[model samples]
Target: MTEESPGAPGGGRPEDVRHRLVEVFGERVSASVPLAGLTTFRTGGAADWLLETSDPADIVAAVRVTRALDLPLTVFGGGSNVLVGDGGVRGLVVRVRHGAISAHGTSTVRADGGVTLNGLVRWAIQRGMAGLERWAGTPGTVGGAIYGNAHFDGLMVGDMVAEVGLVDRTGSILRVSGSEMAFGYDESRVQHTGEFVLWANFDVAAGDPAKLRAAARESLGFRKRTQPLAQASAGCVFQNPRVTDDSLSGGVPRTAGALIDGAGLKGCRVGGAVVSTIHGNFIVSDGAATSADVRTLIEHCRSAVVDRFGVLLREELVYVGVFG
Candidate 1:
């Protein structure tokens, strides 16, 4: 039956939807799946249905079925930089797990969407490929990295991408060149258009393996030292404010952490969430933290920074599911 018509036996009951999906996807589909364990932040309620699959075919199938059923769908990768709500997600959440990579040459590699940014960096470094060395500790999958134009130390993942493989809204597979990606500050065309990245080819450059490894190590070390890597935080809470001629910060990119620190928000706490003393940009959860706690802390910091510096901070973290 088309989405316009109710499904068999139950007239489009949610349970009927789950049962129909089970017939198509088998054990890969789960109900009321707890979400906190799936994310880096380790907080949230659950997903009504979770499809865990390493097969691109399965991913596409899940997407197609959900669209046909008119069910809300969310694609979850190495969950980071997102806060799932306390009330849980209403429909289907497809969790990608197909992390495979292939080296085309010393200067090029291909990666599946589920491959972590850190994994791609290592793969390239191992093959003596350069250009991704500094993203060693960046969280999230290659798909997410591309979607958000993940960056560090003046370098961006988009710079290395040659092309992307995606499943569009209509479930057709297609390829788009890097130029067409329309990458910008923490944003990409895919993010705006709702295309799901399946894989990508990254064009790197030849480099010394030892040097690349050393560079990766140095970058990871710096992140570990400054950020609360051991803590339950969703990376940076806000995007760094751009510098302008009339900006409060001098004409250079201002760090979000510095702004929060300058605003005296470090160690500031609300519920089980606290801005990291080591790096004010991160709001580490104290295990018992709820989504509300994190959201409140984030808002408090945003407001405080605005009040103190007269510059409004924009959140880098995206909200998932629902919350109060």
Candidate 2:
């Protein structure tokens, strides 16, 4: 079957699609899998079809099958930056969990897409490598990090990337260099191309272990002090406004958190979702919060900021599945 091939059996039927997937993927595929436990927010519904594998080959095969069957495909990494809707996802969800890291030549380390950013940081620190130590407390997988050009302080993950191995929409594997990634503030070319990252090689430098550990610890400490790490949240709710209108803020910091705080939205609540008093940008759940609750709170914060400062804040959190 080809990318333009017709759907198999009862076209677009859920059971038919599941059966076809089972035939192709065997035990690797599951039906109606719960999604809440798979994500950092710990909320949302199920995936109609789910494929969890540690093999890049399996990832490519799944994409091919889904494309041939005319089913929608979604790639989930560490599930740290998305809000899956309660209505659930309509098709297959692919989560790659292979996290092997190896030295590429002398100055590069190749990490499987599933490797947690923090895991990569620790790996580099343990080996006395320096570049990743500054991102010690970052969440999600390397794939997700690169997809969003994950940043800390003033540095972006893209800055250290050497190359990326990805499965493009056509199910063809390709190696894209860092320069070709088109990384920007919270974005990469893959987002537009619908390509799936299988692994990435990052540039590293030799460093003293003690110094690397110290830097990693400092990054972790800063996150613990500033963010509500204890609560269930999807990191930052909004991207910091890129361009600030001076007439609106009157010298207030243009950061998303600062704008929300200055708008006096701290401790604001919608159902079980509340804006963290510790950091205005984080919307934490009180264990029982629903996706709807968090989403509503996000809108409330956005509205408040726009009304007060004439600045419409954009979301940093990605929405997955479907909402009611």
Q: Candidate 1's residue-wise lDDT over 89-185, tens digit each? A: 7778888865789987666689999888888888788878888889998988887788788878788789889999988877888899999999988
| TM-scores for every candidate against the unseen true structure | 0.93, 0.94
- Cα RMSD (angstroms) for every candidate in the order listed: 3.9, 3.9
Q: Which segments of candidate 1 are over 4 A away from where they belong?
A: 1-11, 249-253
- Window of ten residues with lowest summed lDDT in model 2: 1-10
Candidate 2: regions farther than 4 A off: 1-11, 244-249
lDDT of 2 by residue, 195-238 (tens): 99999999999999899999999999999999999988889989
Choose the strongest candidate by TM-score. 2
